[model samples]
Target: MRFKPLPADFYLNNTVEVARQLLGKTIVRNYGKKILAGKIVETEAYIDKIDPASHSHPGITKRNKPMFEKGGIAYIYFIYGNYYCFNIVTERKGKGCAVLIRAAEPIEGIEYMKKNRGKTKSVYELTNGPAKLCLSFGIDSKFNSISLRSSKLYIAEGKDENFDIVTAKRVGITRGTEFEYRFYIKNNPFVSKSK
Candidate 1:
């Protein structure tokens, strides 16, 4: 099957709508050593100015400059001093909105992902969380603000197996506890625990 990257228009719209539509899409990254890919099973919408819990709540900075870029760009950030959280910038340029890819199911280069993850043997842990999958794919701040359509980081359409969609509050956040912006494929084994 052909795996062309989705265009900017695909992400230059409503974040919630994009988040729901992203399910089952393939996220691929080739780091020279190996190619890692997975089917996105879960995502969360973060409308910066509107979402209290979004990192942009205070204001934009060097850390969040990527989020303000045009669509089809990666807004990767580091957390807990070690983990990297990846977000795809959405909407028009200067619109501080993004879709947080919460979970993915490994689909390509499984052995490479396992090697990158070191102790991960079960498929469940290969691409379950944002940090986990980034580690498995070798994504870091180096990818910050990279364009998805042209960069090594890209997403493609995938199989559409019937799945139940569920929406709930985003986890691991102290603010916007009432927004209930997180969404995941129901009964999916790959959804991140912060559902």
Candidate 2:
């Protein structure tokens, strides 16, 4: 069954723990009269200066200001000059920690996602990567710093009963590549570039 949107307190935990706990959460996007939802299957943690892969590693800037906010806010950013990536601020305010939502299994509004992504091949193609998921859900830089508890976009609880989660080195990065911060559901086909 679908759950109510998560509260801001739900994100006020350690960065890594938040990433792990988000494994089965449902990310909901309320666009107009339609609802776009997906079950989070993969995530990666960026912990302050300790994690060189994090944008806030060098301290807060205009672009990464949202990362310095309290947990439960969006930190959407543009990359490759072509796609936008979505991240959720984690930990307490001024922690500069966040969790990158790497992938998710499409659940609701599959048709809307398919149309947004211009994809019709398979469900997996709808949200198999950070940028891809944002594209599929119509998220962009404009969403940066928005409250996750808002009705427009929020994360809801899910069937996090017993899904096996595996941790591995984060992908598509050069610095801080040795940290095994990436977490994904074991055997989940929706994971982005899983091993």
Candidate 3:
């Protein structure tokens, strides 16, 4: 099926709202001649200043520069000496806010995703977390700061399916625990975590 990327304006909305609304969107990655796609099942939002857990809270640097760019771009980062996490920059330029793509339900190019992930025992294990999603999609630093409008990586429209959304506190952070910035599709097996 043909996939059309979301318009640039879609990313200009509030980070938290974008994170929640992204639950059913399709994330498409063009890997060579094949197309790898997944339905976004989980997301986390981080806003500058207000969000202490946000990387941009420390201000723009070489590492977090992408988070300050205009909305509709990628803000990928590495952590724990390994693993890449993919995020979509949101709001206006210099806003330093974004929605992290925490998990996705593999839809297209399952074989390619499995090959990239290497020996996944179940389909749910493929793109069920931020790092896993990036690994399955072959995303890394090279993809950072690029336009999501590009065919290489983009969030496309998904099938019209109704699903309840769940909101919870962001995970893997000590600060900003008071804010419930994480969102996921209710009962989605591909969600990174359910709580």
Candidate 4:
């Protein structure tokens, strides 16, 4: 199927708004000869200096340089020395804001996702978290700083459906926890956590 990536302008909005609007969108990974995709179910916004939990809070460095790029690019980072978390850069360049793709519902290439995740008990467990979603989609540091407008990966439109969105505080962070920047589709089983 022909999938068009969201325009660069789509991610130039406020980080929190971009995070909320990402729900129900599809993240596509062009893996080799196969195509893997999922409907975005959860996201978390991290704003520059305003968010102490943001990697760019300490100012741009080699590791977080991708987060400082213009919007509509990938800002993948490794965590706990085990897994990679995928994020989409948002707002203008130097703003250092991004939207973390927390979870996604498997929408295409289920077999590929199952094999990548390895030994998952069910489909719900395949891409229910940021790390799992990255593993299942084969996303890593190599994808960081790449333009999402075109390449091996991109975010596309999902099936037409309306759903309620739930806003909650960002998780897995010790600082800036008071900001309600996390957003997810209400009652989505694939959401990593519900508030």
Candidate 5:
């Protein structure tokens, strides 16, 4: 079935709430005649100041300006000097909140993702991590600050099957690790790092 991209208003909510609710959403990337799509399976919420792990905690910088924009934009960032991570700007304008997209289950363009990832092993290896997911879907710094409501890159509604949603501490972080801001589908093999 065809699904419409979610409206900006759908992201203008509490950061944590938005993160939890995004679990079953579909992330779509249109590349000319090729389309890459996946079901969001893992996410982490970050609220400016309130969440010590957030990039906005230390105030806005050139790198994190997108997170300060109104919800429904991409907050792509480079990490480990090797991989790009994707996030969805959330909350109201200037709030500097976002939901980190940690992992996804490939739904379309699996061949493209496999080619991008250079992996022929298993589907789980293609997008089972933040960096992997970004690479698999061809997400990079170029997508930073882009609107999620746009045609090229957007989020669509997906199945809300009877899967249990689990919450845990954010991973690979030094601060705010105590906050249970990380969410994922229980028993889903696509989760980046399951607890």
Candidate 6:
């Protein structure tokens, strides 16, 4: 099958649905002369303000404004004041929901990723964690609210990602890591260390 990006509706409907659908897709970031892209292997969903652990529960702000936008846009935010976390806004306009890209396995632009990361021995460090992947690819707060189909940081089909998706509890959350919202490829070595 050809790699066709799902419509904006695919992400604007629900966070969990968007998360599940993103299991085998590709995330591409075009940085000037190079395009750093990869196959998505891990993700977690944030449903609504009542979810207890969602970022929007505390009310929207200049920082989380991207999440309230229409879906299919990047909502990159910094966590822990140092880690850059990547998220995709979900639901129609005004919904403060999104799917967090927990981790990814590099599938394209190897040398570029390596150069950006300044390492070559291990591929895991290139894109294993959300913050690590963003840093390697130049994704930052400036990319927030950008279209998911933009020429700069859009997502597209890269390679075939057919397989059974595995579901598990999320990690690194203070209140809701037990909801089983994490989704990843079953038995895929590149899924993540915890998988």
Worst 10 residues of 4 by lDDT: 1-10
Per-candidate TM equals 0.94, 0.96, 0.97, 0.97, 0.96, 0.91
CA lDDT, candidate 2, residue 59: 94
lDDT of 3 by residue, 11-86 (tens): 9999988888888999999999999999999999999998899999999999999899999999999999999999
| Colliding pairs, model 2 | none
Q: Count the backbone clashes (under 3 Å) in each candidate.
A: 0, 0, 0, 0, 0, 1
* TM-score, prediction 3: 0.97
TM-score for predicted model 4 compared with the true structure: 0.97
Cα lDDT over the full model 1? 0.85
Give the per-residue Cα lDDT of candidate 4 at 76. Answer: 91
Tens digits of per-residue lDDT, candidate 4, 1-195, equal: 577778779999998889988999999998999999899999999999988999999999999998888899999998999999999999998899999999999988999999998899699999999999999999999998899877699999777899999889888999999998999998989999634
Which of 2 and 3 is ahead in TM-score? 3
True lDDT of residue 183, candidate 2? 96
| lDDT values, one for every candidate | 0.85, 0.90, 0.92, 0.91, 0.90, 0.80
Model 6 stretches with alpha carbons more than 4 Å out = 1-4
The model with the greatest lDDT is 3
Which residue runs of candidate 1 sit more than 4 Å off their true CA positions? none
RMSD of 4: 1.1
**Which pairs in model 4 have colliding backbones?**
none
Under the 3 Å rule for N, CA and C atoms, how many clashes does model 5 have? 0
Model 3 local distance difference test score: 0.92
Q: Tell me the deviation in Å of residue 16 in model 1.
A: 0.6
